[model samples]
Target: MANARKKKRADIPARDRILEAATRLFTQRPFDEISAEDIAREAGVAHGLTFHYFGSKAKLYEEISQAAADRLDRIHLQATLAGSAPEKLRSFLVAHMEEVHRRRVDYVFHSRGGGTAAIQDIWERSRSHGIRLVLGFYGVTAPSLELAVATRAWLGYFDELVLAWVQGQITNKAAIVEMAFRLFPVAVANAELLGEKNLPSV
Candidate 1:
């Protein structure tokens, strides 16, 4: 069965096969742990094909990381465009969990601050989008510095719960989302204490 799959992968266009194989390997291990040769073997292509398509291993990893971030961004944008605030927040959380589970090891690595600067930058950008989405959900378009700081801190708490859930320590996703829904207003209230006021509810 594995051999048949390998042969089938070999039939894919060389560049795409390499990308697919690299993505699979990346989901299983960090960038520094995977060599171009490993990708070439997994893709059933000449070792030089990865270089031909991407120039270097770092470049290939960058493309894969960027691609994953782009996908999550699309999911986030779609959620924003088509639902009530609670529905959008729930939808985004569920979709985010699905993506994290699909790439569990990769998500865990980056969640634990285990990546190069470039890779971490991509992770940060994704988190920034998430923070903005949560702010939008709460009807905050122009956040003050206090509100922004509070929101970022709230997301850090949210991220920790998500990381635990993905790592199998927490089992009930609904509970996590509900916790976020409940805690968000409190977080904003704290921001109010620091001088921002009249924050809307989730």
Candidate 2:
């Protein structure tokens, strides 16, 4: 029995196994509810191996988020820049929601305890990238702090609206997309920072 277990463990590389297990487990459950032991068990590795490779459960969770983010970046980076700013943003958002749904890892708002920082850091990085994407979509050739800040604020609001959509609190994706298209003017009116030229019209 012991020899059989050892042979099975030798079949796959430990790091890959741990990462695969982490991806599966993390995608299925909220971050805090799962333990390193659980991932180790699922990966068919010794419990200590998870620690040996990832250093901590939080680090393991971060690895999963990093993987998902990288994949999302690769898949949507160009598609989000394809059309007029309004058309681009709408396409980008639809792609984002579909990716999130496929990954089954919308655990950002659900993370608790020690994983909060990891999840939030990923969120901020993702948000900043998104703001830049909108700028690019609009052909904002020269960036300014005021416009950037206004756009960042808009992304925050847009994300919350999407979250509501995700939770079945709001079922209208078109409404979300429509409101998102209107956010630039709203941001301009509220912030008075971005000039008419700096904002998207449609």
Candidate 3:
């Protein structure tokens, strides 16, 4: 049983290695430019193993994209929940900027594929989840349709700022954050409007 468990642990690394290689390739190059053979060569595994594990290049790309999205969501959720609303907003913005810097290649790939059906579906799912999370942070028990529209508008502004920053249109992170803060007075006003009984002082 010990030997079997050890072997199971051993196989995990190979699977992770494949995923890591695939992620690197997908982010660094266009999807059409990356092939299963390239992933297998980079992973130092047999070509057939790529198919054995991921079935196809498209599936592998989808899996890697989903993994990245899941990781970002987890980070955002944790940071938001671990602090007061103001701190949460600050942390979320910083975290998001850091993540965009770290994952620029992934961002480029998604942005460049804007009109692709697969990318559109992924964006829709991610956007829906993001909207729900933002509503939770605002502490709106029953947000009206107008509130939803406002939230989406605010989120779009934030996203555009981050994109601009990432693309070199904005030079300073602190300045960008400050601008975002100026535009996002809702974070402060929401605490009062929601009647959060024990709101922390910003």
Candidate 4:
């Protein structure tokens, strides 16, 4: 039995085994209901080993979410078509939505209410990075104050809108993207009119 256990242990890398088990569990169960011991049992590892590697259940979930986001980021960065801001942003958004649609489990897990501080950190960082990406694509090296404010507001709105689309609360994804497209100018106009307070961070 000892030799059998050792041989089985050698069959899978520790972190990957733990992550695979956790991913399966996360897909089936709510985050709060899951425990480290449950993940250890599912991974066929010693209960303490989950803590040894991940420190906490929250951290494990954060790592899983981050890994999935990294994969999608790689896909989104791949330039399928080189063109102006609209063309590039549209291609990027299409790729992003497709990746999120494919990884609906991770998308739902990351987006909804059951989020930790670690997850919130990821979202905050993503918001900043998204603004930078848009500014680069639009060739706006020195964005005005209104443009920055509007972009921030647009990102906040876009995240919620995409969440609704993912949850099937909104059926028209094209409309979601279409609205996003129209809102760029609207956000700017509102920022100009309302002194950067109208569309204030969704």
Candidate 3 accuracy as TM-score:
0.75
Full-model lDDT, candidate 2: 0.72
lDDT of 4 by residue, 1-202 (tens): 9999979876998888999999888866667788898999999889988888999888899998777666666675675347877777777667767776766655676666567877877756765666766766756666667778778888678767887887789988888888877776676667666464433222
Clashes of 2: 0
lDDT of 4 at 179: 82
Best by TM-score: 1
Residue by residue across 1-202, what tens digits does model 2's lDDT show?
9999888777889999999988888777767678888998999889999889889988877777777777777556867746666777778877776776665444443322235576678856776777777777766655577777887877777767776776678899888878877776677455444453445443
Better TM-score candidate (1, 2) = 1
lDDT of 1 at 37: 96
lDDT per residue for candidate 3 within 38-73, as digits (tens), equals 998888778898888878887777788878877778
Worst 10 residues of 2 by lDDT: 105-114
Q: List where candidate 1 sits over 4 angstroms from the true fold.
A: 1-12
Considering TM-score, where higher is better, how would the candidates rank from best to worst? 1, 2, 4, 3
| Local distance difference test scores for all models | 0.83, 0.72, 0.71, 0.74
Instruction: Flag regions of model 2 displaced more than 4 Å.
Output: 1-10, 103-105, 110-118, 188-202
Return the lDDT, model 3, position 61. Answer: 77
Tens digits of per-residue lDDT for model 1 on 123-144? Answer: 7888787877778876877778
Best by lDDT: 1
Each prediction's TM-score versus the true structure: 0.85, 0.81, 0.75, 0.77
In model 2, how large is the Cα lDDT of residue 22? 84
